[model samples]
Target: MLSKRQSKYFKSLQLKKYRQTEGKFLVEGAKGVEEVLQSDFEVEALIGTSAYLSSLAENLKSKAKETIEAKETDLLQVGTFKSNNTGIAVVKIPGQDRNVVEEKGLILALDAVNDPGNLGTIIRIADWYGIKTLVCSMDTADVYNPKVINSTMGSFTRVNVMYADLKDYLSKSDKKVYGALLEGESIYKTDLTDGIVLMGSESHGISEELRPFVTDPVKIPGRGGAESLNVAVATAVVLDNFFRG
Candidate 1:
């Protein structure tokens, strides 16, 4: 059973302010909890029903500093998930210093992607393509937001997401900045390379400030009658082209 104080603390992690202050975030659901346990991330506390806890291997169970048995109702109340019967793990946020940006490999960068779902899907997409490092502008959605973490479906454990000044980072980098834009070279036609694939927000395309940094403005040619593709979908399309080329 979870103590009142512990329940409150776990619930507080749903908010960005509390997560930042505590340097911890909540990973809800069985899959997410299991992935976090398997990853290098530090699990501070694991809260789950007795059945869920017992189902885990001894080594995986030992990963948590503390484990508490809770009812299904308790989990639903403590987490952002609508239905959480399996578990929720309070995990320590990894230090930003550990993410070292390299100039050689393909790196995905986001600008003002405020949608938590989009950010989460992008992380999963990045993981699928085996792109390890994800750089986000300071204004991008909080990666640790429960919505973001949940949407990743455990891909958050594999992808290293770090927020920085996009402009400054772009200006300093010698690698090409392939900005996804409406009026730009078609991704299929352009000679794709391993560099920074910069994507913008859903409503607004790439911001003006970051435009000058885009060495290669690329886009996916559309044959359909859609105004624009969702940021996450666009990312998957662009990355697929990059992977193929």
Candidate 2:
């Protein structure tokens, strides 16, 4: 059973401020909850319906410090989507410092990629390519957004996302900057160094504010009528080549 105060607190997490203040976020759905359970991040509490609780009783029993069986409606109140309330797990924030940017090789940087789904898909792709860290500009979408988290499909467990002053970070790093651009040299023909691969927003390419920081600009050639490729698709293609090279 969920107390009124608990329900209110969980629901408030949907807002960014509350999540920041409490240093916790809600992970909804079975896959997301399972990821949280398996991840190193601390689990604060777990709430679910009886059926949902019964389904994962064994797994949730050990990892979660507190587990409460509540009505489906109560679970829905705190969940991002009302369609499926498999479970809701309150996860402590992973306190990531800016120092992670100095880590070597193929760091993916996002320049105002606003779509949550696109951001999540990119994170999944990054995880698959073994690029464990992502640097997002301050304008990028929130990593913990429900849409972003849902789209990641549990790949978030292995990826570390950090927001920073991307332009300044790129400028100062000794790592070569490879920005994806329209008129840039073909990715197939270019020689990519072991460094950061910067991708841009869906609507706009890399922001003008960051263009000066790019040491190497590359592009994927296309013969199609479309103006450009989707940022997520482009990211996959670029990472694949970078990973293989």
Top model by lDDT, which number? 1
Off by over 4 Å in 1: none
Global lDDT scores for all candidate models: 0.93, 0.86
Model 2 spans > 4 angstroms off: 57-60, 97-99
Clashing pairs in 1: none
Global lDDT for candidate 2? 0.86
Q: What is candidate 1's lDDT per residue for 1-245, written digit by digit as tens?
A: 99889888899989899999999999999999999999999999999999999999999999999999999999998998889889999999998676777556899999999999999999999999998999999999999999999999999998889989998999999898999998999999999988899999989989999999999999999999999999999999999998782
Root-mean-square deviation of Cα positions for candidate 2 versus the true structure, in angstroms = 1.8
Error at 193, model 2, angstroms = 3.5
| Model 1 per-residue lDDT at 9 | 83
> In candidate 2, how many Å is residue 176 off?
1.2
Best by TM-score: 1
Kindly state the number of residue pairs that clash in model 1: 0
Residue pairs whose backbone atoms clash in candidate 2: none
